[model samples]
Target: MRRVYSIVVSAGLAPALILGACLVLAVSPTLVPAELAGLVRYGPFLLALLGGVIGWWFNRGRAVFVMALLLICYWLLVGNGAGISAEGLAFLQIATLYLVPLNLLFLGFTAERGVLNPRGIARMLILGLQIFVMLMLAGQPDVGSALYRVLETRFFASTGVLGTMPHPAMIISAIAVVLLLIRHKPLETSFAAAIIAIDAATVMGAGVIQYGYLAATGVVLAGLAQEAWRMAFVDDLTGLPGRRALGHAMAELGNQYAIAMLDVDHFKKFNDTYGHDVGDIVLKKVARELARVGGGGKAYRYGGEEFAVLFAGRTAERAQEPLDALRQRIADNKITPPEKSKPVSVTISVGVCERDEDTTDPWAVLKSADQKLYRAKQSGRNRVVI
Candidate 1:
């Protein structure tokens, strides 16, 4: 299941789906009902604004404010503000539209829970506002028709360049990609950055920039859904699948399977000696190792220093080597506490159980593993009992 998730995310599935939706509109604008088509054209702004509002109400209120700022910045740049029709201006300078979304993406990646915070968002907005003002000033800089005129004059002249010297759009694009690659949620960030790149290439069509915003919004929506799923089914401390996800996994498993219950040895000592913070670090490290256990096992955090590893289509005999190796690995890894130089190590005791012909319930098999886990813990922890 995790492999499938990695594959889908790496393949850019979310943006692909949104891109498909956008293409349908671009291709068959008539396919939509008259009312819907009008909504598509006129309602997008309102709908996107509404989404920002909804985000605020959903405790992602911070993002709504950022969205509002971004919307205002975009409108200021693209809207009919100076009595001079924006339509009349050559789009060569319009590459400036990339800033707002790029700003949001960078801010979003830095935001807590993926929602841009007020202080950070404010700074970005202020900076973005200043940049927009600068662009407006650079509008007729006979200083040059473009920044890096050498790129057009001497370098790749066919594809050409946009904006003036110190090309902010290209700079932001490079910075966005680098930042996204380093951030925790690289896939989503990179997806938004990729969309921005495509938007940069088609900046002439003003409408394309809006599509880029919509695509960013789509990523935000998908992120919300993924967060909801994580809160319910992923263990916060260990970053592993939780009990709810374990139940779902078992539901899809074949009858032939082995399950193991693991408990961190002397986990209470960590909390007593250091704090839950250190305990959390231990759990996360332990889960990380368990996730890579051999024999095609899947790991889950089964609440409070305890973990579960399920090996579908594998018997207890086949699962033993991996379970024991997992035990040995946990025993060997030294966990370093934050702000402390001394490294400490912990171990785990595991109990493995296989589904029998008479046992139809996977939970019952899990219970068997649980019982054996207790026995292993009782008989001097750090070994696997099957």
Candidate 2:
């Protein structure tokens, strides 16, 4: 059940759900109010702008670039109001179909260096160059005609559900989807869904194209929101829930819950001797052992070398065996730092307290556990005190 929950939350299900809802609304246009019908035409552009602002705020370079690129593509394809010739419009459509997925592929592999750096400015310049080239092609009948021929040429026979999509564009989109799946991070999963929606729009006709773009933009935006939430609540180094998450969890604790506070033995001294890099490795190793604790325990990083575990329905007495085992497992493990032939040992001191008449408040229980942890450290570390 826990594994299933993790998969549901981590596998980009939020974006997938958003895509499903958008598809439903797209197919049942009558479900949309007649007064708000114009939203279908303008909503994607608005969403792209909002997404760009969010990306910039989060310092997610890929989101900023992709959103800007998508906004430009949408403008040229639908919102320009330029009264472009039919041939020019066709050329722009083909160009956008190819460009969007290609850029998604490139940006997926690109590192996030924030939105205002030199690399980011270079990315923007490249996008501007592409936009300029696209406009030049659209304005020149002869050049646009030559490029359109190449873009429209079918490389293979089209059939089945996606037959309406151009062959070259379909191939590019498929490759991008496959690569994004291989990456399989939340943002990449969202990008894969967006590419699939764009391809479906090509096949489903113009009436639903706006809905497709809406789904694409909406899913990516949702993904950014999820990433931001994770950054707020999850510890980056140890992959454990952070102190903030621990506080949230404690707020809803049951009457029989036990809270265990743990601190690395001699961590400051060890860090100074072995350096911070090796110190991080030791913390991660300790976290891994703590995460495997039985008795329904949920481990969290409670700032620096301090950690916590909550056993929701268990008292300190009930939680003792597993806590002791966790302590022993961590003590048994050895970490070999770089340039060291002998492996160094790492251990922790734990203090546990359960909810009782005198300590009904969760914070009070946590403080008692922290005080016990200090006792364990003073009583010749590498032990558990309850």
Candidate 3:
């Protein structure tokens, strides 16, 4: 049953079906005037449809399923109803009744899953479409009346990206904010930055004060959210992967790669000799070196006096050169320990293992790596063993 439902949700038919129904109602020309009220009346259904789709996409069962059902109810409530017009409500129904909810739910779901990287660039792309639609609406011949119609009735108000794109120039600013937030990384490339700037200008030209404020606030909020997420998944002390981050990464990567457990040799002894503060400094220095050496692979602080490195698409034996160089780098570099009043050096031991395809599990692979690490320590103070 669960599998069947998920399949249904993932289908493109979900949104397209809703849109088709609206299109049918639109072409038939009902006596009921399709006004903003009628459009707003069905907003919940739109939201539900979106939520369900997103839920299905991200495997979020309950929220998505519930939203889909609620949306169906909305369709029933507004069907062939009096006071709904066929013409005026055409775009309203399609956008508010369908697109808004679908996009909102999808966006929220993707964000919640921590998969908002470039892989999900489609989310950002849809947002761009919404912005275009809003701009078109704002430029309508009777801009004032259209604005009043969309805003006053709260048509598609439930939609998260601040109603349809067509607000005053100021509203463009708000859209800019939404765009920035939805982006995984801050815009740095020249073309990207220029596009963003142009989008902002369009919003300002629309003359929507609230839009400007919302855009600014949304950008800041998105940045904050991104930072908060990073902190949640990052190690503060060593700048290595924190335990929580490691878990999240494992959940994401599953059994697709190799695991290497690396530990600083005699870490506790160093702390005892140099004090915990200096110990912390040494750990950070080591983490930096590890991150630098690992390249492309992730480095994590597994726990006290221990670090973990994950190498993608490689076997344990393949890590020999990199691990050897890492150990050598640490031994050769002169690290100025914090409050140590002098420079010092440190060494690290590494245990690496490729994922056993027959028994593909991170924990098991990690255990194997740990065992190898133990062997390295037993063999000598500083070395890499598989």
Candidate 4:
């Protein structure tokens, strides 16, 4: 939770700083170099495309990923006032300031699922309706003026505590951003930031669009991409570092180190007797026990039914106590399978080897540990053999 909170806070603050800078630049365009003004003017679409690409990459072709395509379309259609009646473009500008918030809300509500689900379908329908209304209102300035007058008369006037944003749209947007931050979905948070930033650009009247908004969104997308990379190296079933990660660990280990190769005894038999689902639970339980091993041990899931524990700068004898304790914990643990009447207990066989005169290479030490593990299995499992 703390990690999630920190991530949310960081993503939230990034957009705030970005939008604030945008507003400042809008006020004092002179502070921005004339050379960079062209980039600021024409860079939003490209940056929006970059953000979309990053989001698509992290999500991995999920249906919700198509939102990126639609987002690009949104930039092309409404980002700049173009190819529309002057009065219609004015209406779109006014409508989009409020509509973007709704789009963000829709994105947050359906971050994982696509339009196939009920919530997603409904939101998309309403969003389509909003776009249709915006299109209809385009080139209709007299209606826009009259509608604002009626709306102004109907709603009760209220003053904001912060005088900088007295309008209801700004207050609603602020509330939406806070709510999205609380959800802690990285891509959703970034999407909301981009929407809010772009809308703020519209409200500021500094320019037709602010490319900085897309740039900020791209930063958030980059964070999501990083998380995706981390997830790639993590084992899905046992939540441990995978075999590839174990290779990395082996490469990092010093000459003086102990490697322990462990495997759940009769794992295949257990899987056959119980369902694979229960077998997965057993693996997860054993993984938890192995993860708690001490003596500088770091555990990894080294392929099916097998795991590696690396004790950096420790001898096999020094690491024996922790390994033995881990074996005992797995033996004693009572795991209840889903829809099963009784709890089942499982055991692990460990083979430990330390770097020595005969085994200097990490792989050599690992192979030695594996051989010892095979010996333990032959001599009745559930014990550590060195």
Which candidate number maximizes lDDT? 2
- The reply for model 1, stretches above 4 Å from the true place, is 1-11, 20-36, 61-66, 69-98, 113-166, 184-198, 201-204, 338-342
Across 1-386, the per-residue lDDT of candidate 2 in tens digits comes to 43344445564687778778878887898999998889878888999999999999999888888888878887776756374566666788888889999999988787778889999888889999998888877777777777888888786676775567678888899999999889977778778888887777777777788888888888788767767767788898998989888888888787789999998999998789999999999999998998898999999999999999999999999898999999999889888899999999889999999999988999899899999999998999999999
lDDT per residue as tens, model 4, 310-342:
999999999889999999988998887777889
Please give the clash total of every predicted structure, in order: 3, 0, 23, 2
The C-alpha RMSD of each candidate to the native structure, in angstroms, is 5.1, 2.9, 14.0, 5.8
| Least accurate 10 contiguous residues by lDDT in model 4 | 60-69
Write the residue-wise lDDT of candidate 3 on 1-386 in tens digits. 42343333332322233333433433343533667534434444444455445545554332333343334323422455234344333333333333333343343334333224444344445455664564355345365245445543442344433443443322433453355345523211111222232233232332322222222222222223333444565676776658887876776664457788988888888878878887887788788888887635778889988888887777767777788888999989867765556777788888988887564888788889899999999998788898
- Superior by lDDT: candidate 2 or candidate 3: 2
C-alpha lDDT values of all predictions:
0.65, 0.85, 0.54, 0.68
The ten-residue window of minimal lDDT in model 2 covers: 1-10
Cα lDDT tens digits for candidate 1, 186-226: 33453354445345424435455444445555555554445
Candidate 3 yields a Cα-based lDDT of: 0.54
List TM-scores for all candidates, in order.
Answer: 0.76, 0.91, 0.48, 0.70
